[model samples]
Target: MRRFVCDCGSPVYFENDFCINCRSALGYDPLRADLITLADWGGGVFRDLQGNAFRYCSNGEDFGVCNWLRPADSPSQFCKACQFNRTIPDQTRAENKERWLVLERGKKRLFYTLAQLNLPLLSGWADPQRGLLLDFIEDARTSDKYPETFVSTGYLGGVITINAVEADDVARATVQDELGESYRTVLGHLRHESGHYYWSLMNPEPMLLAEFRQVFGDERKNYQAALDAHYQNGPALRWRERFISAYASSHPSEDWAECWGHYLHIYDALDTACSHRLLDRSPESMSMSERLRAWSKVSLMLNELNRSVGRGDAYPFVINEVVAEKLELIDLAMDRLRTLH
Candidate 1:
């Protein structure tokens, strides 16, 4: 979430397509990890001032669902981020198009953070066995067209399926209330589900699995049974003392995903803080304990600012000593995972 500036010295945002100040067209270059102000070279091709040739993602040209750019020499019509999509809502339907647009915005933001982390990313098309992909689908609850379908926002076999209704704020909020959730958003769901994708990539060894069980719980436990119990009986009275969220208490695997999601949330927030000059160092330079200590001061000020504006706390969750230890394990595991290839 770093602040961006247009070439004309005007403030720009990551999602901006046209700069309001200089009337320049903006395009994000996935290779350079930058938003460039484009100059029309000729006949639908564009060039950054540095002479890097590019083209807008096809979705951007056709449906305006993306703002990313791909190298002109590349054979792909989609940008690196869009290449991950295995399916999308029907664009012919106006409502579905609008929902897909909102969903793309969230997906792009998620991709931006993922790129910033320097994690290994590949489209499932490129590596069918283990690469990541996304699918935006709807079910009976969200639409009348499919009365028997039920698609949850989840990751399985390298595919992330996000229920299309999650794009609609009212629908999402209604579900949040129905489920008694304190916080939920399209970005949060993607972040949490992506943890499952990467965890599959990790495929823990015996020692690692043993360590994860000690920190979270027995991941070997029945997932469906645990979820059934969670919804039926609810979390323990002191759940917050251990889990980052009530849902995290449902199963050990979920605990891992929740911790994984928060690990990302913390990184992005600190990255933003550094961008704003409120923090003096990059998150990569800090230890896990240092990050927690820094986040405490950072989150406290953030909560106070939210209170000042009469909004709820910007961050509703806290990391206790136990959670901190779990995060450290996640950090270590990710470091090892990243080095494998």
Candidate 2:
């Protein structure tokens, strides 16, 4: 993520709601893609330093789950980001409020990276037919009130459904341990699900599709059967030599999505590293080969840093020559996908 600064010249963060130095209220402007310091002018009117008038999102005022800003003159009270939500967890339960906050922060970070990559973002409410939406829901397993309901985090059509428990650290760690996964987080879930959403748009030209098949395998296999088999027996040995994760080995389609998610992870993390002067090269300036080389080195150092702090490796997967070729395919496909915008 990019570092942000408050209008008061105090260093702020993407998730911040107040500026420490100026003691001014802060809201993230999705349009400007920055945190803005606001001054309360009384009577519910808030103005930024440039005199841009705004209002906190209704969700923010009601439940403190949102930090986005809406224009004071906007016809709808919801900010650009909040307008994309089709369902939020029931906020009557206090725990739900905190879980929703965690979910939104991860979603915002996902949206930020997509925006940075110049991908198109539209709400289901806006298009109804093609636009995207999110649903953060709870099931019987997570809440007693929701008997007979079981929700899994996944994407279908254009909607992404995230189980509310994924936002809870204990719940998430339990699943992570059970699955024997090396890395998992709210942002990782969002990025992975988004890969499914984008795959629905990957109607590449005939030549490109052939190339895709050569690298990532044909995606025509039965997805459900593959997933079922994967869950029953686990990934094949030496899976890491070819796939980004054990789950990626389940199906050709999954392999693509897993690689796509890693592409975003590597790109965004590398960009942040460059911004912080931790890397000598910028992602935009490096060739695909150069970028991968830098990423391999940086990721190793990152893992070591975690080890030094007595934590697990920050990134636990390896990127071999074969995986690098697949990633390059992703880069090409992303370039093609952006043209649709």
Candidate 3:
């Protein structure tokens, strides 16, 4: 993500609702992809320095879960990011408020990166067949109301359903340990599920399907059986030689999603590098091979920097030769999605 600066010259974060230094209000303008220090014009109306007008999305006004802005003259109450939500966690409870905020923060970051890539993002309400939607739901683990409810974080058809407990650090860490995962987070889940959503959007043509099989294997295999086998018997002994993560070895689709997620990781990291003058060109301007090579060097530096501070690696996995091939297919798939009719 890009570092934002308030008009008062104070550096502001992406999720800030108010500028600490200047005491000005802060909001993100999706049209310009700029986070602005707002000039309040009264009655919920505000404008940026360029005179572009906006107001907080209703989700923000009602629940304080979002910091995104909608066009001042638009009839819609929700911002472009919030429009994709088919269901949000119940907010009657105070704890759900904080959990929803965590979910919204992850959603906004996911939307920002997808928008940055210029991907086609039709809401499920807009295009019933191929559009995307999100649902944040809770299970019995954290809620007394749903004694039998269990919702796994995943993508099916066009909707991505995330288990609400994932927002709580203790709960997430417990599950992460139980599952023996090296890494897990709300943002990672979003990126990974979105990869599945986009793949459906691809609805790959024969030639593309043929190409995908050549790289990621056949996705037509029995998904449930594969997952059952995966959970029952861990990844192959040499899974790391080909897959980005152990869970990815579960199936071809999972592998694709894992590679796709790492592609975004590399894209965002390299973009940040260019913004800071660490690199001469943006990730968009580099070839896939160039990006892989640059990212290898950069990711090493990132991990070393984290170790210097007594923290774990920010990016824990390596991009092996086989994983590099899967990422190449992901770049190609994104190029195809960009040209959809």
Please report the candidate that would top lDDT against the real structure: 3
Off by over 4 Å in 1: none
Model 2: residues with Cα > 4 Å off, grouped in runs: none
Question: 1 or 2, which is superior by TM-score?
Answer: 1
Scanning candidate 1 in windows of ten residues, the lowest lDDT window is: 141-150
lDDT of 3 by residue, 10-115 (tens): 8898898789888998998888888888999998999888898889999998999888999999888999999999988888888999999999999998888999
> Candidate 2, residues 1-341: lDDT per residue as tens digits?
77788876888988888988889999999889888889998766689989999988888877887888999988877878788888998887888888999999888888888888877778888987768899998999778888757688988988999999999999899999999998889989899888888777767999998998899888998889889989998996789888889999998888888888898899888988998889977787877888899999899999999999999888999999988998999888888889877
TM-score of each: 0.96, 0.96, 0.97
Backbone clash total for model 3 is: 0
Query: Per TM-score, what order, best first?
Result: 3, 1, 2
Tens digits of per-residue lDDT for model 1 on 22-79? 8888998878777899998876689989898989999998898898999988799999
lDDT computed for candidate 1: 0.88
Top TM-score model: 3
Every model's Cα RMSD, please?
1.3, 1.4, 1.2
The candidates, ranked best first by lDDT, are: 3, 1, 2
